[model samples]
Target: MAGDLYPDHGVTGTENRQYNREQRAGKHEADAALYKSHQCEQTPHPGSWRRHDQRTQGPLVAGYGIYTQGQEILLTFSFCSSLVSGYVITYFPLRGRSETIRLILSDQGAKWTEEEVQFTDWFTANCEHKKQAVFGQLPKFKDGDFVLYQSNSILRYLGRKYGIAGGSNQESALIDMVNDGVEDLRMKLVRVLFYEPEKGTEKYEADLPDQFSAFERILSQNSNGTRFVVGDQISYADYNLLDILHVHLALFPACLASFPLLTAFSDRISSRPKLMEYLKSEARKNRPIVPKK
Candidate 1:
């Protein structure tokens, strides 16, 4: 569905309605207290703190936090969205391609709001949003006044903006490679899901071992199959790979049987404290991967 000419969906409703002014003030105060307690080296911004240096070793890579002796003290500070309230994702009610972006935001503890568009409205002749989109497609992303289209482009933009793209230029290149690889596989899956469910699914299942081996090898090549995909720290590519793997698991329950590293990697990424909470919540569970046409 996503690779089609039109792409997915979006809405023009209120931006990040879940967060109110009072909630913002309360969170800002809490962040200040956390900053004071940590004895941070940098000054606090209006709503949040700056990101920790990538060289610092800890559990978190993007968020503001300091590493103690063998312990990670993550500070819930997102400088990118601090000045403003938070990011707003305008897409269809389904998870679709937007889920990866949502996972990165939630894992980083960044505040974001969803602007949902109903299917009835999306296909209607009088759909104003269709006329407004740059490419006449959905899954549009808005960061303050800057609006971005194309799901992968949005992911890359956020990855760079939030410091989760990669640690170095080389790692960034590797990350991009991994993301493109995932996109290729995802497009194949999309063809099966949206275009030819009967014949394509059978072939996709038959080629599962060959298709998944690359990801498995990637895990083994990096840190002896222990940490994330590309680097020691988590990158946006990890989020993309994990999301696609998750969808594959749903389609074929035994998909990862031959890939031990991938299974463990999925388990580790899914166990992240903040991401775990979001994964188990109704907001994620209730949304279908592909719409019921």
Candidate 2:
């Protein structure tokens, strides 16, 4: 399995650490502000979760500030990634790429650590070497000395390791198809949105109809009257779609309002007990630091 899989978003351990710290501080600040504003609460629901200013930590440490320095996997989350549904869905399974790995990791009860990193800085710093890596870019996974980049490959590794990839080869292949299909749709949507912003709202407005229509069609076809994207059980695909949907709803309300099924789906997924908890916790812990316009 390892031989067939490639790491899509591999970066040096040092770089990953730096990126994670920044992300953590940003998320923490955002949560803190959200809590203060009464917008939300923290997840895992504990009285001990206190909100604080990240800047107070003083002059931002370079690397490995909070993460346990041991065998662990780093998942980078960023505002840029969260801004677009396509990118969120393509990489972060909860938002889009495929939540298979996330689900497997959660199900296996793996106690892996998570780290958020800014998408822009990470990409800019490593853009020159993207083609050299197997997975192309991030949402990379590092276990011990080995690093796996591609989101799908990471999911498969986690599934197989945790005995959740599937009961048979046919099932595993199906999972891959669903995951790849979501990726394809998300990429197309992103291209339409980002390719020509200079054309103004007219162009942006014109493109959304078709892209959103396609998303609705795909969701309708894949729906079997179940909340999960594929099969009887929840997989990575569901999480990927959910993450993307949340971002879309948050950033592009106009686009989301046009599609009722997508809107409902997004709401349903986000309200899941675990995710809701996470969101609440995230909101309370990370105070939003508004940047100057």
Candidate 3:
């Protein structure tokens, strides 16, 4: 999977660390301000879950009540505003597996920053950052002090954190099913792109129709394809599926001609306000689906 997006390249571990340190340094001040304003220390809530400020490595809790003998407990609580400070994605410059995660953040208008990993940095034998990856892969994610690897896990984590997974257990399972299906197809695409770019492209295109029909069928089950794939509200699955559709659309402009429902689904998702803006931004531009060979 790492080879799918990250091909062999070379660089010094020290250089990669220096680059990340600089990136983190630039955002430290602004992130600190956001933490101060939104963290639990400033805004407490009833039965608030504990959160940590990664910058300070301090605990932030709320909703505890003071008890007095033979008196009612005075619970101090209030509605807490959005306390999620920011997110960081460390990946190579290509869209690859990380694009879906980016789409979710953009659609939600969440604060986030990217720590671009040069190809050389990922493949470097002595890369300190590489050693930190539990799975020895790219696209590691960070939310405050918590760190996670694997693109699918990161997507689900964001989905749950942002309440986009679904409303019910059944719906959430359906959403996961959709995302897993998308991942299966994505792996096939990766094979063609990285393993056999010469002759594999033609064969993959030939089978593309049958592959896409599965998603088209999924959409047909919901509002004749007008609604989201799993539930009424868009889930992480939508983002993941839409990203793959975009990539296929680029590969075969006429790919979705036979699947009107999918075409509409892609159109509708791309038209979302924040997502639309992100799709056109410089940050999204020039980043190829895969890194250049």
Candidate 4:
């Protein structure tokens, strides 16, 4: 359906309305504390003091707390509306980590009030003077007074806060293993497709068969006819792997033609009403490509 010149359904208005309604409800809930603080006209929470004290006493990533006081942490990326938010929230899955955290506050939603700054602009404006701030970095979270780098660590912190890391240590380790594997493969693919187009595309085409084969093996082994990636319910592993697979298909449509199973899986996942709506909104908005080259 997606490969067709025009999507048959064409992302209906009803779908947009539904998404907006859910989004507004979520935003009000997420901003309740912020709103209440404003109405009270009070200083920041007492926890801010504790947070500052901890950062002062504890090890700082560079010289600042991972999150500064009173700053809404901005998760920086090239395509702010794309799958980056999906990856972060699914992995982190904490309270106050719904669409509002990933989408609304990040200036991608219809009702966002914050000035939407490009990731590059925001980084240059804030982190340029800090020697510890790294260049060519992304998925960085910036709060009012502090900045935190490292996507995986951010994900871990979010997951721990949300209680989605795993019920047991073994499960958590498995989640990490699966996530790392997917991320590793994704990075490799991105390098080839975007970083060094000619060389990378050549390498990608050459390795396409092996890559599909590996995923086929994984699906055959892990999936027992269920639609999800792991366990009985959907987990972060499923979402991350699906996103990785989706990227591959979007970049190289022919790649999907060879692997029927993967193609079928991709189709099935993409056909989901929610995911379809999300993707269509992205396409309509002309979100930048992942690598943004």
Candidate 5:
């Protein structure tokens, strides 16, 4: 919505249009050659996207994306509240896995939208008889012309795109490890919630030490026992694991009493400078982590 290229990448909307016109007119061969071979670079960064030509390989406006789609899709980086415009994530009116993905975008100071559906309505939409959705699943995410399903897949894509994978192979591996660990623990909690809602509280409290301690150990190993679970920075795993930990905190107020390191780590992530405002904003507050059952 902001412009043809990334808002803060290089040229303005007017400038980009002029450049495109010039290129089309075959008037600026020097600029055109530069644009083609400028070696545009996109960094693994948070809250913003950077692209430029360094005379190497990059998806340029002429050779690659972000321009081919134009305003029809926000394929380039924009420094808005969310990464792209007209982004929509369809899900039930609850936190669940969708919320973690939502939190990742929110933490990155991106702009997006959410669509909450009721279970009965979703069932009707995707029943075997009706077969409205290809996957018959909730949390279908749409960004510009791109549509994505599956919570983990979406998070992984965002992580890789937004530089939340910690910028290295080892860090990425750690992220994957932490993510699997969180999922394992989450399934345990989910089992209780689905089959034994009455014991959700007791079950979470009982599983706190073993389940949460694993995370504490993970955090301890990364960055010399400092904050975050991977490479001393926020990764896809952190957002995901935080979602699970937040659920536990909600279920058991004293869940982190014994895990001092985790307590501090949670506090640190929850209070991220760029993300704090959105986390505490009215918009975020409106979406409760656990919708009323």
Candidate 6:
């Protein structure tokens, strides 16, 4: 563009290319320096490494992206200010995947902490704390520097390590079955809650009976469904299922009564000493059951 506008400027094509390249380089370098000094910036997309001048002091404020020939190449970067725990899950401050994992940590009394992220600053930070995430999704588990993705996979790893998965292969299989069911419901509910809030409520209301019925039957099969979802003790399956139930009941208060076993199961799990205390804590209290208007 510079060369086209100034035909008499005596700049050759090769010189023009080099000149433009240097101009872009200078822009980025200046932007970087300005960001480091001021702590943040508002930049357009379709570019590389937009810096995150975070107000908070922590590890790797975030990562940015690169756009080349109409393709986006995501690059992750970090500016570590302090050492975070070996066990950390970075996600939006919501009780979604992270919450289930939090339940695991709370129940097991594990040494863990959180890395809550902000969406507005996500891409600018070059994916920041979520760089190691498998698909750039949230609730990524970082053990020291080793990162793990997929919420359920992290839960399973912890479950296996902590002995909460189960004692036998058969038991693990059962837990998987329950966990799969939870995921199916979770996906649907997520679509409803986030994307289709207006129409989803009525549609989900119609589907509730059948959905709750399936879990009711599962609970009914296990020794009259008087206890946990599987086996005689608490398993990793309970946390996911319990979270699903929590959201379902919050959205549809009367939906669980038809499934007495599930209702009882929800109450029982929510009453567990550690979990009950968690329910009463500021974390759970502060987090809204559904997205706010």
Q: Please name the candidate that would achieve the greatest TM-score relative to the true structure.
A: 1
Write the number of the candidate with greater TM-score, choosing between 2 and 5: 5
Q: Report the lDDT tens digits of candidate 6 across residue range 91-199.
A: 8767888888878767655446777777666666676665656687877887666778889998898777566777789989999999999999999988888888777
Tens digits of per-residue lDDT, candidate 1, 1-293, equal 21132122211124234325444454555664564464433433444222444322121223443333223334443333323334788889988889999898888767678999888998999888777778988888886677998999988987886678898999999999999999999999898888987675777899989989998999999998899988888989999999999999987999999899999999999999989999999999988988967
How are the candidates ranked when ordered by lDDT, highest leading?
1, 3, 6, 5, 2, 4
lDDT, candidate 4, 1-293, per-residue tens: 22152243133445444444333444444443443332311233422211111111111111111122343222111112222222322212111112223322222221111222344554464644233435444444553234555555555554453444566787678767776877678678767655776764766767878866866655565554345444444345545666667556666778767676666666775565545566566432454445243
Model 6 lowest lDDT segment of ten: 51-60
lDDT, residue 222, candidate 2: 56
- Between prediction 1 and prediction 5, the one with superior TM-score is 1
Off by over 4 Å in 1: 1-84, 198-200
- Give a tens-digit lDDT track for model 2, residues 149-183: 77767766655544444556876776667667667
What shift in Å separates residue 81 of candidate 1 from its native position after superposition?
6.5
What lDDT would each prediction earn against the true structure? 0.75, 0.47, 0.74, 0.45, 0.65, 0.69
lDDT of 3 by residue, 1-293 (tens): 21232222122445344444334444444543453465434333343223222111111222322212222122212222244444788998899989998898888766578999898877879887799999889798987668999999998888876678899999999999999999999999998988978776888988999999999999999887999998788889999999999999988899999999999999999999989999999989888987777
lDDT at position 208, candidate 5: 76
Candidate 1 CA-lDDT value: 0.75
- Model 4 regions more than 4 Å off: 1-136, 142-147, 161-164, 198-200, 271-273, 282-285, 290-293
